[model samples]
Target chain A: MTDKIPVTVLTGYLGAGKTTLLNRILSEPHGKKYAVIVNEFGEIGIDNELIVGADEEVFEMNNGCICCTVRGDLIRIIDGLMRRKGKFDAIIVETTGLADPAPVAQTFFVDEAVGRRTRLDAVVAVADAKWLKDRLKDAPEAKNQIAFADVILVNKTDLVTPEELREIEMRVRAINPYARLHRTQRCSVPLGDVLARNAFDLERILDLEPAFLGSDGGAHHPDHGRDGAHAHHHDGMAHYHDEEIQSVSLRTEEPLDPDKFFPWVQDLVAKDGPSILRCKGILAFQGDPQRFVFQGIHMILDGDHQRPWREDEKRESRIVFIGRNLPEENIRRGFAACQV
Target chain B: MTDADTASLTERTRAIVPGGLVAAVHFLKDTAAFVLGEAALLLAAPNREQRRVAIHDGGILAAACDGQRLVTGGDDGKVMATDAGADSTIVAVDPKRRWIDQVAIGSGAVAWSAGRQVFVKTAKSEERTTDVPSSAGGLAFAPKGFRLAIAHYNGATLWFPNAAAAPERLEWKGSHLAVTFSPDGKFLVTAMQEPMLHGWRLADAKHMRMAGYAAKVRSLDWTADGDWLATGGSNQLILWPFAGKDGPLGKMPRMLAPAQGLAVEVACHPRQPVVAVGFADGLVLLVRLDDGAEIVARRPGAAPVSALAWNATGSLLAFGTEDGEAGIVDLG
Candidate 1:
């Protein structure tokens, strides 16, 4: 077994100082080689010349988001880099401003060859303390980016006063309390602060997630006792629109039959392909403790088995979707239909 | 009539719909519009007074009008079914596979192909099973019949509704993207994504190669007369006069303003020489072949127009978009 190389994903709203933070990390003399990927090396005719040692290891997809069109290119590049083994100590993926990170994280889990070599260290998002407050008011993508982040850096601190920064930080925390917060100018934070920060603590996340991550760190919930009428509280974090997009997470203790799961997923895509942006899950199949990872964009889906369940870990399944005006009750019923 | 006379007549009938609402009949039950992004589908009744019998989700990958029930296959690897007056139901789902690229239903049997595998289910059984090779991309049901013709990744295959008989395969070398059978089932036309169109004599397996577009051929339809083939891609529609004498005549299918965006779906007027083209930029163009005139050009919504279909009478046109919007245009 190869040692899992930690991967950190950097995301932010457009012009939120993500590239600035990446530049700071590259300049530091941490003695660890970092492979960085971005949407474009040169935008508006301005080249990315600030990052140190980016010439050899840096790659620009230029094809749009790292999730959809350029995924194949991403897999090939990461696979080749891994083959070199000693060339880079870690990988940092900088997503496009409007990208959804679920698909990027899913790439690491769904691909067998890639999963063995890389581990998802954390998802770090940079926010323009001033712009984020307004952007999240109407943009579903912006809110979703904040909600899914494991760590958030409130950048452009110089533009806002300490009190304003604190307010923004509080707002972010309200939406996602799990993420660690930091304030910086031009995303100029220390590399140590961002690197090796494992934010996806299974136990902690499971505790916060009552429906999926039980207190036991298992994905199952023994309490069917709760009424099926459990309403999801947006908690003032999510903005509702008649055509708004919603992200929902579902977990199951029962193993899914691949036959049933496969068709159920297909039907959802067919029925609502335009509204669905991303769908991902770690499934536990009957008699198999090994994790089955599934990820999709619109209608395109790719799935495979990752490592077998660790002897110390419990087997359970969890799935999440980020989409526009998703009928939560209908989706839940559809998932319920998938139950054996 | 000779081929020229037929072309002239079709050009004349193209003015009937001349844009605007070609048909509109509200459903007794409320039905939501579901957009498949690149395509869209809706489940609604054809009339406000009929029993809920079918759902229709217009998808470019596959579109099925089964009695009053309409089923659509989306690029997202899903098959949705709905009775005319009821909400949509996901009859089959495969999120882990490639798009449900094409769908066809007939003789109470429905078959769809996604990322190479073809799945079929009949009204007699509630369960659907994979029944074809994985390389299949396009599929069609023999008109008013139980047999199915599937355009595989490399070729095409004809299958019986019952599993008792083995499928007959027709080998080809190209990536077949679309397939349609002639009205009499005597000929099968396959369109390649490479922009090449071919006609095959199903009885003897003879093939004829024809001219196609410069880019991927996204939508294709055959006129009821079987004398014209309407193909569109790269925002332009081409009317192939299959039976014309004008130097193997193939002219741009007349439409309201050259199709302005990516043409995603196209349907021929069931009984006329007219054709309807739906675009990725949400524009719908009704074209007449007689003088190559565009009769209608309208943007129904902000999303891309993904699917298009003409009802039984060829009077009502239904279209769906990526933004979950569906509209009915009345040609009457």
Candidate 2:
């Protein structure tokens, strides 16, 4: 699996320093070669031979299913890049300011040739720290860039005051509490923080828990903490309720019935996959001794038995969803029905 | 042939290491031309003499051979034609340095795509350009006409380079990748983005949906008589019959040579009904269409077999793998 090339997707609103981050990655002295696929070519001044332009063409698969859509241009570009396999160490795809991240993420899942030759490292979103609070209110694409990201860079923090920065962080957290956030000026975060993150790998499901358990005080008594009932206290600030998008975290000590859980989750995603952008879970089955790690992009779910549960580890099931207008009550009751 | 006579014929072939991923192999006369994923093409002669010829400044993206010269398009924005004598010449270059996405060789013309536009250059006339609605996913020239088929999202456009009429559009709902016409010029088939092959009967504009593939159908070839269209996408060799007027519209495809690995490439014999099947696990088998008798040409210990081809006379077979391992088998 290590032989597969790692691809990092960079997204942001216009004037959010995406090109700055790309140029930085290209000009860094890391001694690693990168093939950059950018929608806008002349914006990147780097003279790298591996830099290729993309058209950002998205098309539907499985007979016009919206959730099954993928980037047709990515499927073609990756296939072309694989011909020069040894020329580059990793690939970075920079999307347009108005581009949706769903088609880019789903391209890795839907295309067999792309999935086999390369692994999606992570989705890195660069946000203008001063203007993000306003963009989130007006641009739906800006909110998605934050919610679908695995790592986010709040760039241009020098222009915003400390209090304004705190407000921006709170608003981002209210929408997506899962992504690893970093504050940077001119998008100057460490190169390691954004690249080579195996965010989509099934084995990396272990990292999802810390993102959920770290901030919310509800992690200690998660059973009493029903879905959509986060206390939303961050640095003693009141919960900023962004009504359109939110993250729901569910946990239970009871082992789930695999037969019941599979059908319920499948049906739920089928009905609400458009609203549910991303969902991941590390499940504990009733009779199986192995832990099942599953992750989804829209309606597509990929799950497998990771390893045998260690005796020292607690056999708990935790599921998290970052979506818009999720059926909170129905999801909570359906998950309860899966508990044995 | 008896089962014992055809089994385990791995020693009947001569191995040649090309040392780069072989995207395709085409037989020019008696020489096996192995098109590498990078800049060169390996030409192996019948006497086992191999020569490497550089055809592109960078990676070769698309290639097509018309029994004389191999025409290839590359990331260097140049289209080149190389012959069996190791001689190469630039055919065309994109002024904007766009990656040449697809290429097709017509009777006397060479066609290639850069972004959404396709350029066709004939032997006697200058190049003509036409822009499609989307990026051209695949390009194929009709067997008997000067027309070219450009496969893209929503459908394929059939264009005649000399005609003044608006190009014909065959509307299908999904993105179409590789495309080819039957040898008899009756049907046009396209490998879609989905795991299926969609075809249109040219006479009546009828649609034929060939589904039930586990993966996208990347490689397909018509038999010598155009009786069957062999495809790669499943663990078994799938052949959709096109002998009837309706094509494989209501018929079931004949599946053969079930294996542990998915078949990734298929090359039909030019003079016989046998097919050379290449699998993802680096296995190559020559299976007869009559009874599905299999002859193991290469064993499974390397990368997927990405390319396979037979000489015009069907006396020699050449196969190449993704790991750059190549071999030529003599069956005369």
Candidate 3:
């Protein structure tokens, strides 16, 4: 698994500095060669020889599941890139402005050949700080990109006032509170913040728990105070006020029953998969010493037994779901019923 | 039975190091043309003569052969053909430098795909092109006519290059790859993005779903009589019976040569009921369909075998691996 190539997906709204970020990644003296797959080939002046073009052909599976869609072009391009395995160190895929990042992220989990040779490192989304508040009203794709991202860049901060920047951050935090947010001008942030983030790997699931809990447990919640109220007001805006997209995190000190947890989560995902974009969990099953780590993109779920519990670590179960119009009460109730 | 009962042909094999991973291997009479993953083709003759020919500017993406010439599509946006004498020709190059994703060879014509468009060129005719709903995943020429079958996202499309009629679409609601027409031209089969094979009976467009594969089917071939379609995706060699008019609709597939590793490539003998099965653990076997007898043509020690082919006379079998190990075995 260590030898598998890491793939970073770059997404944003139009003119959100995606090309500028890509050009910066290629022009930097990192000394690591990357094979970049972009929607338009000749627009960016990238110096890499492995730059390829993609048509973003999203394909649905025949199983009658609506949420089980994948990027067919990524499968083909990755297969082609694997032929020259030693020629490049990693891969970066630049999606168009109007594209959804779910299908791109699901391609790694759905295809056998692509999953065997490469792993999804992260989904980095760039947002125009000046225009994000306005675009969030009319563009649902922009919100989907923010909701599906692991790292987000509020680029073009130079064009906006500090109050407007604060408002943009509040809006982004309302939609997705768990992502690592950065303020940048022309996407001039460090490259380390956007690349090689094994955000989807099972082994790295709990390593980012500090930020996850920090967002959900403290400042971003509705009950928490000023920043929280601002976030709530931001969620009350035109597009997502009644049934908005948000992240819900559940935690319990008691161990969970394997029999009850498995059936409930599977049934939940099967029933509500189209509304759910991403879900992940780390469980402490009754009578099991191992930590069970799992992640899901829509209806497809993958889980495995990680290492055993350490004596110093607390035995807690935690799970997070990011999606549109999620049933928080039912999810909380269903999760509470799985506990012993 | 046991390993002791299986006959051994390991001693009769001659090895050839192609210097790169082999994408495919095609037999031109008595010679084996190994298409490397890079930009070269290594030709090895029966009398120990070997030569390397540079064909593409970048990695080769897809390859197909017509027993006399080999046609290849590369990431360099070029489609090229090489004959048995090591002579190469540039068939076509994409104007926008889009990668040629698939290639298929017919009687006197050639077909290749770039993105959602498929281009075909026949002798004494201009180049004709058509667009599919999505990227062309696979392409195949019909055995009996001037027709071509292209597999894409929703299903496969059947086209007649010479006819002015609309191209026919066989819908199955999934991504289809690696399409082929039965030797008798009675049925069309496509290996889907899922780990299964979907077929359509041309007489009536009836759907035949062949499921239960462990991985996505990558290699499929027809038997000598075209009665069986052997596929690779599981631990055993799976052959679906295509002899009856119903075409494996109600019957189960015959499984042979079960190994510990997954079968990744398969090639059937031209004149016999024999199949060369290559496994992910680098094991190659020849299985006879009559009684399920097995012969160990190559042992499991190197990388997975990615390409396999049999000569027209079935006297020689060629195999190549992902790590560039290749060899030819003389059955005679």
TM-score of 2: 0.96
Instruction: Name model 2 segments beyond 4 Å from true.
Output: A214-236, B2-8
Model 2 whole-model lDDT (C-alpha atoms): 0.88
How many angstroms is residue B223 displaced in model 3 relative to the true structure, after the best TM-score fit? 0.3
A-chain TM-score of every model: 0.58, 0.93, 0.92
Give the least accurate 10-residue stretch of model 2 chain B, judged by summed lDDT: B1-10
- Order by lDDT, highest first: 3, 2, 1
Ranking by DockQ: 3, 2, 1
Q: Supply candidate 1's per-residue lDDT for A224.
A: 18
Which lDDT tens digits does candidate 3 get at residues A1-340?
9989999999999999999999999999999999999998787796778999998989887766788889999999999988888999899999999999989998999888899899999999999998888888889999999888888898998899866776677778767766777788989877888898888889988755754663252234332211223333444443322137787889998999999999999999999999988888889999999999998888889899989999998999989888888998999999999999
Kindly report which residue pairs in candidate 2 clash with one another. Answer: none
Which residue segments of model 3 deviate by more than 4 Å?
A: A214-243, B1-8
Write candidate 1's Cα lDDT for B1-332 as tens digits. 24454344334332121121111121212332232322333334334222322232222245565445556665345787655445567768775534455667777777776544677788785544445443455788888567788875457888775666678888765556578877667777787634567667776777666654555565678877877777766557766555543312244433333655767678888788788887767777777766666655444457566567777667666666544455666566
TM-score (chain B only), all candidates: 0.70, 0.97, 0.97
Better model by TM-score, 2 or 3? 2
